[model samples]
Target: MNRLTFELRLVLRSRLSAAALLLLLLLSVLAVWSGMREVQRQRQTIERLAPLHERDVAALAARYPDSKDAGNPAYYTFYNTWDPPSGAAFLALGLRDVAPYVLRIRALGLQAQLYEGETFNPEVALPGRFDYAFVLIYLAPLFTIALLHDLVSAERQSGRLRLLLAMPDAGRLWRRRVGLRYALLFACLAVPACVGAALSASGIAATIVVLAVTAACLAFWTGLSLLVATRQWRSVTNATVLMGAWAMLTLVLPALANVALIRAIPVNQGVDLMLAQRQAVHGAWEIPRAETMRRFVAGHPEWKHQADVPGRFHWKWYFAFHQVGDESVAGAARAYRDGLVARQAWTGRLGWLLPGVGAQAVLHRLAGTDLPAQLAYQDAIVAFHREIRHFYYSYLFNDRPFGSADFARRPAFVPHAAAGMPGGTELFALFLLAGAVFAAGVWRLGRLRMHGGE
Candidate 1:
């Protein structure tokens, strides 16, 4: 314990070590605060939209008061659907930055409304947000390199390597030093994260999982740093090599993998489905009204017995064809969603190799802001859209009048429950990689000799 305390003082007294630790702590706190602010902004936006949405609905109701036909009401009324942030969302603002959290849909072909783009600046979003996940995955490793790259090189340069290695318990001494630094680094990250989780009321289980992942990541980088530092090289050379590896792991490889994954799993079917649905909906206008109704009733036998269009337009016919348009490209929609899921699955597999990606996968999954979460929101929208179609169908097929009073009866959109945290497989892969690298590092350290050789 005395020796450990001495080593702690030695590390703290080093200007570089003290500065690196302070910088990491500051960055971690700033990241957590930034993430919290963004989450609060989203909540405020959702809250603000509620009143505005209500006013819009009221104005539409007032405009079409006592309408005899349900078509006008169904065509004009825009219902709002929102996916609120999960409790852990402040830790990692994943796809939420680019994707729309709130969407407006009507009783129309859902595919058209589902892919509507948000109005965020692409330039601003290009580099991604500096959330807690960003800090942990990208910046933490650099801090690790800065602290550990000179662990042995500095001693060798100062002619103390021979004396240090000659000590009776040299291995134990190295362990104490490395372990203290590791603990401090882990604390720097975990403290801010725990505080954020507590404030957000995030689940305890999820927070523990995030902390575990953070520890594993730190372990990997610390191990790698030790492995490099133990090599017979200058400290500057060691730092350069470690920084290059960091860039490849965190930035370059992930970007390449993303490009490769997109190529492997074609998701252009989303755009194709959108265009196809538009054509189907527009093409209906050129076809005879009887032909359109025939096609609509063929799929929907429930309305097959309904009377044909009495005049130029009918609510039932209009809505039925929109349903038909959605159904026409159902296969493409499924393929597009399947492609997205495939990409996510492949990325999870990639985590087994890249600790940085692994951390991202686990954190975003816990936060319910990954691609899977976005897709789950879409699924909820589809379910709610079905409910809407049914509600309007009851009025349209049965020829019941729609009025201002009926506007209040419109079905409200409820987002799906938050997705469960990342599974054990991903967590296990992360720990396994960390443990393997750390063991390798320990083994290399054991082989270090007083002769300034590995």
Candidate 2:
């Protein structure tokens, strides 16, 4: 035990180890800080919009005091719905940056509002956020390579391996050195993660999950490094190969696979739905008023009391066309949703082979910020649209007053839990892949021959 402690001191005392560890720690801290700042910015934006929305609603209510007609108020007033970031959102901002978190929708065609994306600099989003997930999945392996790629090779080159192995505790010596390096690497990575979780007030369950994932990722990196080191190649050669492998695994494969997936599953149907809704709503003007009422009454029999189209401008007719437009594209909307679900499902399956994407899938799924999570938000919007339509339709169809009092009765938007996440399967696949790689590296390490001559 004393020898092991001394070995750890020796390894950590080296300028190279100290510097590399420091750099890793610094990057991790920077990443967490950036992520938290981004989250705070989004929260502030959402909070700041509240008074604006309230004032807008108040002004419209004052302008149109006629409570009997909801049509004018619905036309002029826009209700804003925002999905605030979850407590664990900072760890992996997920699709929050690219997608619209705050959306304003009116009683007009909801299809137009549903698919409208937020204005974001694609270049900023392209590189991805510098969050804890990015650090763990992309940079952690490089640190492992830096520290362990020359573990055994350097000793052999220094004429120390033969003598060291001849000692009575040779196996113990190798374990001690490798274990010490592994622990140092773990601390350098895990400490920042702990600190970030504490500062973010992230849930205990999420923190534990993050830490376990961190350990698994480090284990994979450590095993890969020792496997390469066992080749007895030059230290420079080992580093070059490991880095090349890192690039291929982390960047190349995911990009290529994403391209292939996009090509395979085209989800441009969302745009088509929006276009169709616009056409239907505008086309209602050219058609007879009774025709629109006939169509709306077919879906909503309860509106039979107000089905009379008196050859005049009626809010009921206008709203009927709007609901019909949404119904017209319902099939296309489902197809669009299925396309996204398939994409997420396949991405989860990739976790079986690609550790980076695999772990990423797990992290975002837990945080409820993945593409599916975004879709879930969209689904919430759809449900809320139905409520908004119904709330306004009551006043329009039943001739109920929609004054300042009714504005208070307006249906509030509620976000639901993201359902049917693929984490358990993803976790299972990740461990299977990890086991396969660890086994192969173990076999290769055991078979390594040290001498130059066969």
Candidate 3:
């Protein structure tokens, strides 16, 4: 304990180590605060939209109060669907910054409405958000390298490494130093995250998971740093090698893999589905009304008895064609979604090899801000759209009137429940990689020579 305390004091006395630790702590706190602020802003936007949406629906109801056909209300009224952030979302904004969390959908061809673009500055989003995950994944490793790269090189350069190694229980001594430094570094990153979790109401299990991931990531970097440090090389060389490795692991490799994955797994089905649905919907205007109804009734046999088109612009026929349009592109929509899920799945598999990507996958999945979460939201919207169809079809098929009283019965959108924890395969892969690297580092350190000259 005394020796550990002395080593701790020594680290604290070093201006570089002390400054690096302080800077990391400050950056972590700042990142957490930034994430919290952004999440609060999103929540505020959702809250503010509630009344506005209500008013908008009320206005539409007033405009179509006396409509005898259900199509007027169905076609005119737009329901709002949104995906609320999970409690841990502030820690990692993920695709939420780029994707739409709130969307307006109607009882029309859902494919056309599902992919509406939002207005955002690409330049700003290009660099990604300043969040806790960014700090932990990208910046924390740099700090780790800075502190550990010179662990033995500096002592050797100062002509003290030989004397230190000559002491009794030198292996134990080095272990204490490395362990203390690792704990401090992990603490520097995890403390702010824990506080942020508390502030954001992130659950205890999630907080523990975040802390564990932090430790695992730090362990990987620390192991790599020590492996480089114990080599017969200068401190500058160690720093350069470690930094290059960092860039390759965190930035270059992931970018290349992403491009390769995209090429290998084509997801352009989204655009194809959209175009197909648009063609199906617009082409209905040119098709005979009886043909459209025939297709619609083929899928919805329950309404076959009410498939008669009495006029040129009957609501039942109009809605029937729209339904037919959606059905027309069902295969395309399924393919698009499968493509997206494939991309996400492959990315998760890649996490086994890339710690940076692995950490991101875990964090974003836990936060419910990944591609799967977005797809789940779309699924909810589809379910609610089904409800809308049922409600309107009741009035349209039976030739019942749609009035203000019926308008009040319009279904309000409810966001889907939060996705559970990240996938097990990714987490297992991360732990395996971290353990192997750390073990290698420990073994290399154990074999480290104590000579003053390389």
Candidate 4:
């Protein structure tokens, strides 16, 4: 205990250690604050849009009263669907900035409405958000290497390592030193997180998970640093090697994999589907009405009895051909979806080797902010788009009136839950990286011999 206390004091006295610890704490706090602000901004947008959406719907019904025809209502009316930020969304802010959380769909061709992009600055998104994920995955390890890389080697260089090892309770001495540094680093990270959670009013489970993951990450990094320090290498060499590894794992590998994944699976069929759907919907105007109704009734036998084609403009035929438009590109839609699924699967596979990528995948997956979740949103929109078509088809085919009252009673959209936190893949990857670093450090420390006191 006494020897460990001495080591802690020695570390505390170093100007570099103090500065590094302080900087980590500050950066963490900044990340937390930035993340919370982003979540709040999203919430505000959703809240503001509610009334505007209501007004838009009311205006559509007011302009095109029932008995007028379902065609006009279906043509001009827009349905608003939004995915609100989850309680824990502030922690990761995954994919939210790049994807549209608020979408305006219509009773027209569904494919056209589904792939619309959000209004975000691409330059801002290029660097990615400096949220909790960034701090934990990118910066925390650097601090760990900084504080622990010289754990034994610096003492040896200063001629105090021999004296320390010669102490009666060397294991006890080492434990105390490790504990002090670990606790100090953990506190620097945890304090900011606690404050952020409190500010966000995050759920108890979410806060606990965040803290647990943070601690686990710190423990892993500390173990690696301690192992490397055991090698008794020069502090400069240790720092260089560790930082290079961090860069490769966090930045290089993920970017390379992303490029390869995109090239391997080109999913931009989203645009092609939209264009085809537009042509099919608009081309229905030139087609014989009987042919469009034949296709619509074949797929939808329920509406066959009510099918009727009116002169000039007909809602039944208009909406029927829009359905035909969506169907026209079904093959491309499936291919696009398959491509996305492939990318997601490969990313999950990549997580096995890279802890940073692994952690990112887990966080976004848990947060329901991943690509799969985005695709799921599209699926929901497709279903709702179907319901919309059904609603219009009833009024058009059966010659029923789409009154303002009916408009208020239309089927509304229900959002799915956010995908939740890190899984075993991340835990396993973290273990592997830490284990390798520890082995190297141990070998270096074992080869080392020490002299006297500072």
Best by lDDT: 1
**Which RMSD values do the candidates have, in order?**
1.5, 2.3, 1.6, 3.1
lDDT of 1 by residue, 1-454 (tens): 8888898899899999999999999999999999999999998999999999999989999999998878888998888888899889988899999999889999999998887654467798898889999999999999999989999999999999999999999989888889999999999999999999999999799889889989999999999998999999999999999999999999899999999998888787455677789999999878887888888888788888773887767778788778889988888888888888888999999999999999889999999999888988999999999999989888888889999999999998877876577899999999999999999998898888987667
Give the CA lDDT, 0 to 100, for residue 425 in model 4: 65
Q: What would the per-residue lDDT of candidate 4 be over residues 1-454, giving only the tens digit for each residue? A: 6766677678779998988889999999898889889989998998898899889888887876765557787777888777777766777888887888889888877877776564356687898888988898889989888888788778778777888788776656666766788788888888888888787766676677677667667766776676566764777877787777778877888889899999888777466777777888888888899888888888888988876776777767777887877788888888888888988888888876766776677667655678877877777778888888778777777777777888787778887665565566665665566556545544433444444211
lDDT of 2: 0.80
lDDT of each: 0.89, 0.80, 0.88, 0.76
- Candidate 3: minimum summed lDDT over ten consecutive residues — where? 445-454
Per-residue lDDT of candidate 2, residues 1-454 (tens digit): 7897788687778788878888998989898888889989998999999899999888887888766688888887788888878767787888886888889998878887787673456687788788988999999899889888887788888887777766776656666676777788778777877887888777778777777777777777777777787786899999999998899889999989999999999786556778888888888899888888888889899998888967778887887898888877878888888998998888887777888998898888766788878877887887888888888887888787777787778878776663223357777777777666656655555453435201
As a whole number from 0 to 100, the lDDT of residue 59 in candidate 4 is 88
Clash count, one per candidate:
0, 2, 0, 12
TM-score of each: 0.97, 0.93, 0.96, 0.89
**Full ranking by lDDT:** 1, 3, 2, 4
Model 1: lDDT of residue 365: 92
Write one digit per residue (lDDT tens) for candidate 3, span 86-129.
89998899989998888888888888787764346679789989
Select the stronger candidate by lDDT from 2 and 4: 2
Worst 10 residues of 4 by lDDT: 445-454
Model 3 clashing residue pairs (backbone): none
Q: How close is candidate 3 to the true structure, as a TM-score?
A: 0.96
Look at candidate 1 and tell me the lDDT of residue 223: 90
